[model samples]
Target: MAAVTSKVSLKLMIDTESRRVVYAEAGKDFVDFLFYIVALPVGTFIPLLNQEMVGSLGNIYDSFANLSTTYLRPNVNKDSLLSPKAYYCGATGLPLHVPNVESSRKVYRCCRNVTLDRNETCSCGATMNQESKYTVLPSANNPYSSEGDFVKGKVIYMVMDDLAVKPLSTVSIIALLNKFNVKEIGDLEEKVVDLGRDEVVKLLKASLLTKTILTDVFLSVLKEEVNCQQEVEGNF
Candidate 1:
């Protein structure tokens, strides 16, 4: 087994058989991680974490519109992506269609010819006459291409934990929490380190985590441990 550390706050113990982390340690300083985190949109950053590679930002040559829609959460009453106004397309100078809860089911005026079929591409062959009022965001040809790609200008807050190449370790994750200034009930640092692996899982489950670590990965490891124990008992 070899332990590897990076300039970033993450560290890992590599087991030659699986080439995966048997253990990990996260550092206290989050300035570097947070610097990169705020610089890109969540959609773009997710892909980078999964693929371990970056993609070029898509061309923002189209127009934007006030796409107001109901939020998916039942508790959220209403939300608006932009003002309830429409802008002309960059290429065609045509009025851009803003999507709303009602309009989502109806055919869009600008891309009317484009199919509603989810399987195929929706493109309108419009050639731009002049600069558009809207800011066009980049897009990818592959639907999943943006899994780990990074964009230069946009910023976002949340990210999926599983996308990380190696999820942060317990220590590292605690450091992250410390960085966030989560108020400790008592002896938080020492208590966390002293907990058994299973007890750690239970402790984490009981506590509310507003900012998550690699939840799926961490839970999976715990589940695997349970299964391994079962298998050993069966053999005996």
Candidate 2:
């Protein structure tokens, strides 16, 4: 018995068994000793505060998100994308085709780059050469009812946003700085840090994001530049 007691005492010191036992007993005496010691009111207050916050926030009623899951809400009305009465005129680029033209038999008239050869000329001397006229008829393609003359040199506005990248609103400056580097970054790093800490984090807004889809890279760049200039002038 004496030998066993001595061996256990020795093992306690070696393995921190004595400390573990003391800690367990101490913890039971003072429930949550670690949290009380380290977190103080935070541990006790969290659940209470969370309950209070949730209770307060629960009072906020939203027409959209607040609809009871048990009570099914009626879906809002949806409008059709294309309006039937609306008509739009886009650019006239298609060629006026005159098929079955014979070189020898008939006198032909040239109109708006369209030649009325023998096949196009009616027996009544009516020239079949079509001078393409723009019209505003309800169609699947153009639904805006835009005027025919509105096709030339129009400017468009666009926006781009993402998280991993800089905010779009701030991008105007950031992009300028990153691209042109009018001012060095080392100087602005502190300002950026201050903004990160204190500001509302309104993102950089990139405008006039010209999409070069299906366009040659070089041509797109020039076209985009032109578009940008036109947009600026038009806006101003």
Candidate 3:
């Protein structure tokens, strides 16, 4: 599959005084990417981040990676565990890309319609090696099958700093502002940021590690840039 070069734009409402992102106003693309994270396999987490996770999960993954295949059953494929396929088919055009298992996986069947092993013999003695074509039927309950990811398209979503997601509304905005106790409107700045692959990866990692997902992932980088600009101005 080709790389996803597209970037999604997120309009973040940042509190200047607090130096934190209150929430992000986003579209289906951004929301879809966030939702897709939930479907990722447990084995992919440490490898995807290229760092230690919060607990002993990282150590366990490392041990599995280094373990010899000699001890395992002859039919076992190690790659199946280390880099398992993600079976979700709803998310499309995601900036945070993972290969769709449904599309890439090749299925073979015998007359009995068994799909487990390609070369295994069926009860009728027929070899299950004949490649079969299959179609993924869209769920009857899926309303946005025409053009949408996990959620419906053409709807603006509000993603909180803690990764909470909801449909955008005037009432929601007002409630958020009141919750944050924003006395001055000037302190709340709306900034549109482009999220590409790298930013998405940071988001994925931050989502797992912290409750202040947006602040921890984006705010620290923003502060560093500001600090660098100040230093440059001082030198001039």
Candidate 4:
């Protein structure tokens, strides 16, 4: 997995009256990160949220964490469930930077061409653990050949508050505006927000628990800033 050091910028269209994010205008990098969310394992969500997931899955994960190794099979590793790797065809370059979650690597094979574990003996009895590097060869059928993960690069996308994604277009924007009953363009505000690891993590959590994902993840922060300013004014 490539280290994503740079932050992705999202141009959010917020409804001031509703205190909600109507949609976000995002590029390939942000879209790629959104698409990558589905590829994550069920177990990974717990660690990503620091065990604060809003369901019984957290309890199950905690139970497993406290389980004794002596009662389990020798082949079973706790880390396997706690930090299962997600396989992606191409580099996602997500800024989330999940600690143990990583993209899948090439499968290890024995010299006899039998499927075998790395450093373990095969049925054929040859201990040749040949490591083959996996590469996505570009072809006419390959959609990922150009750039980006899941979606093609160089195009902007529209991301709804509920995490629904689509290519940005005038029609789509108008449709969303109509759906939200947005009569006045003056009520809509455009804000460019920088999404780093912390913000992305909050988004991940919000996506799981709330339908108004963008509003829950971002608007609350804006409300806090407003409240702080009001408090300072009151102090005067």
Write the candidate numbers in order of decreasing TM-score.
Answer: 3, 4, 1, 2
Q: Model 1 residue 126 lDDT?
A: 43
Residues 66-137 of candidate 2 have per-residue lDDT tens digits of: 555556423221111110011112322111101111112123344433332322443344644444443455
- How do these models rank on lDDT, best leading? 4, 3, 1, 2
Instruction: For candidate 1, give the lDDT of residue 46.
Output: 27
Best lDDT among the predictions, by candidate number: 4
True lDDT of residue 83, candidate 3:
67
* Strongest candidate by TM-score: 3
* Model 2: residues with Cα > 4 Å off, grouped in runs: 1-126, 129-134, 138-140, 143-145, 148-169, 184-236
Q: Tens-digit lDDT track for model 3 on 1-236?
A: 22555888888899987788999999988887777677567775667667637888888877888989888666556666776655443334354564423323356777757553465555566667888764445577743232235787899999999989999988887888888888654679887888876786778788778899898888787788889999999999
Off by over 4 Å in 3: 87-95, 98-131, 140-148, 184-186, 228-236
Model 1 clash tally? 7
Across 73-168, the per-residue lDDT of candidate 1 in tens digits comes to: 432212121212111113221111111101122223234443222222224434222222333343664211111223322222222232232333
Each model's TM-score, in the order given? 0.22, 0.17, 0.79, 0.77
Model 4 lDDT at residue 230: 100
Model 1 CA deviation exceeding 4 Å by range: 1-26, 29-31, 41-43, 46-216
In Å, residue 24's CA in model 3 sits off its true spot by 0.5
lDDT of 2 at 186: 36
